[model samples]
Target: MYKETLSSGIIIVPMQQEHAEQLEALQRIVFPNLAEEELLHADQYKKHVELFPEGQFVALDGDKVIAATSSIRYHFNLNDNEHHTFFEIMGGGWFTTHEPNGEWLYGMDVSVHPDYRSKGIARALYRARQYTCKQLGLKGQMTVGMLNGYAAVSDQMNIDEYYKKVKNHELFDPTVSVQEKVGFEIVGLMKDYLNDPTCGNAGAVIVLDAGKAI
Candidate 1:
């Protein structure tokens, strides 16, 4: 299992069956408004560990799961900007679409507890994801970033304007901004991507090139 201790004193480790309940609770806290169908449960987490143990990770504070991320391997064509819903991509949150020999690592979920925000947990988990990508010789990491901050200013602007503002640094998004700061690059905008009213069901397709030093 992959393991590391961050300077912040948080430990990053591979996900296991024992972590499912904590992870499920963390998910609810991190994404309170996430679509019902897209929410994950303990059984799905166990299924993920059974399917791809190395691709799943959790950040711990003395055995407490403060953050977690789940990923699945897939053959991703960088040029393909086709739209896909969160449920479809995540295989109903069970990561049932994993491809053992796929070309890229697709991130299904990333969650950091509210109390642990800005303490480097998310970045650490992201680094762990990159480590797994390099270890598996995958091309890179890919994910649809949530526009978590959009809800606050949603009444003032449409998603397109909000996206442009976020991209230009005129605004900061809890998800997209953090992902960009940690090395992911926006490739395209995904509309109607999930049942997130806060983000107008929008998502940003982000990619990290593991072929390069990340």
Candidate 2:
């Protein structure tokens, strides 16, 4: 009833009743400082609940789920095409934007337990998710990432300086090269939009496309 695959000597599959605790623990460690509304807690499991049947995947060593990725399906209508579904967003859960529901999957909220870092678990999990998306006939996937606030301004708006004043750090700079290695395209930026108060400013929004796969 569930999809199964093996990676790096570990078993990867769709999460089931046995993985509730492991998933909860993973969320706590990966998302600790955010508020209730800002945070994605176990209570919100319903948002991703049904996806387990069609959109969730996990990487496990023995009985331990070390890495995970959740898939989201968004429906969108292409501007040029005649009411056709073209955009789908997916990622490791670090970000979420418009819901582009179509023949596509949005990869969201990816995490690797600290103890198991740098072990290729994440890469394996990502591939499995991609495989699932393709199997379901999704043409591609989309994702967004946090970036610096300086370049988020438009000449008409002239809000670049305000962006810097809001966020004091450049930690989320999307200009970095690492994000490129994973097949993403920089699309847009949101300035002082998040209002994190703590992080000081809003973050950048990058779009990644996973080209057609067979």
Candidate 3:
């Protein structure tokens, strides 16, 4: 039950079974574009807590969960050339790929309620993840970041071009931009990372060194 005060009334805590229902509802609200089969259920939450309790975290305003980040450890060879999709890396979305002796922490998802956007909740969750990685002595943290603002400009430029623009600060993507600000660097791009139409079926693989000076 680790807790971190975010503000006068907000805090972050390890996800517990008691937060299952709220977590499910919050996922639906945050990722409404995801297919029904893609959204997590209460039972899944229970499984997550059982598999790796320390890897899951939730942000709250008193008793209400406002944001969450799910993660799992995996044996990732940063030198490997084999490109893996989100489902493949996540073991078909069940996080069954988690390896206790894995070298890196793979962030499965981070969801913040729309109403709470730009409130520093997501940044706080990321800081917690970095702390977890360092404490576990893992190599680092990795995630496929969605390009939340891609759709609007995708037709005018290829994904690669857009990505370059983002890297050069000529473009801004709601999701990737925040990730960059948090110290994550784009490793590459992924296709079919998620079914969400907003991202144009692509995402950016971002990585951050857990032991890097903050």
Candidate 4:
């Protein structure tokens, strides 16, 4: 497992391939609506293991992986409508080639073992992502789901408006909240993004400017 201490001197590290199953199980418990096919697939874990093993930071209370968080970076391609004057004034950009290497981090899969909850483990893992982003020279971070988003078919063929009624829909996952607390901001919403029956509503998209990294 990869490991390090935070500015507050807490130990944290990366989850190993061996811990992938546990992480998936934990994520399912926390985010039951997430599609099993997409979120818990073995290949998905393998990709993370290969591409972001170190980005998948875990907290160890001994030899066990107690909590975990990971990130994936890719180019964001912004559509024309997003180029409005107000959007640019507010720095509304992600789907574009502007970022050096055309990169943005998809922060995902944060989970804390029951015994480790309330111990600030999530905060540490989040700090680790920020640290990695800074070290890699990334420009920003993004996440899915915020408001009025509902699950639709893979192609968003049909969607339900019930998403506006889902409780806690605006609340960020622990990882997302950490990103926001450190200056990440909500950029846009992905309507009917995920069609999986498991995920309650479509996901929201959030962004954190690289300049805000601590």
lDDT of 4 by residue, 108-159 (tens): 5466776666766776766677777777887666555323223332254333
- Scanning candidate 3 in windows of ten residues, the lowest lDDT window is 77-86
What TM-scores do the predictions have?
0.95, 0.63, 0.94, 0.64
RMSD of each: 1.3, 7.5, 1.5, 8.4
Local distance difference test, each candidate: 0.89, 0.51, 0.83, 0.53
User: Which candidate, 2 or 4, would have the higher lDDT against the true structure?
Assistant: 4
What's the TM for model 3? 0.94
Q: Comparing candidate 3 with candidate 4, which one achieves the higher lDDT? A: 3
Residue 92 lDDT (model 3): 64
- What is the per-residue lDDT of model 1 for residues 51-73, given as tens digits with 9 covering 90 to 100? 99889999889989999999999
Report the error of model 2 at residue 124, Å: 1.9
Candidate 3 yields a Cα-based lDDT of: 0.83
TM-score winner? 1
Q: For candidate 1, which ten residues in a row score worst on lDDT?
A: 205-214
Tens digits of per-residue lDDT for model 2, 1-214: 3444554577777766566568767867764643434444453344465444467677788898777777667653333212211121222222243243556565555677888766666656666666766667766654433333334443323444443433343234433223444554444444443324332333333344455221
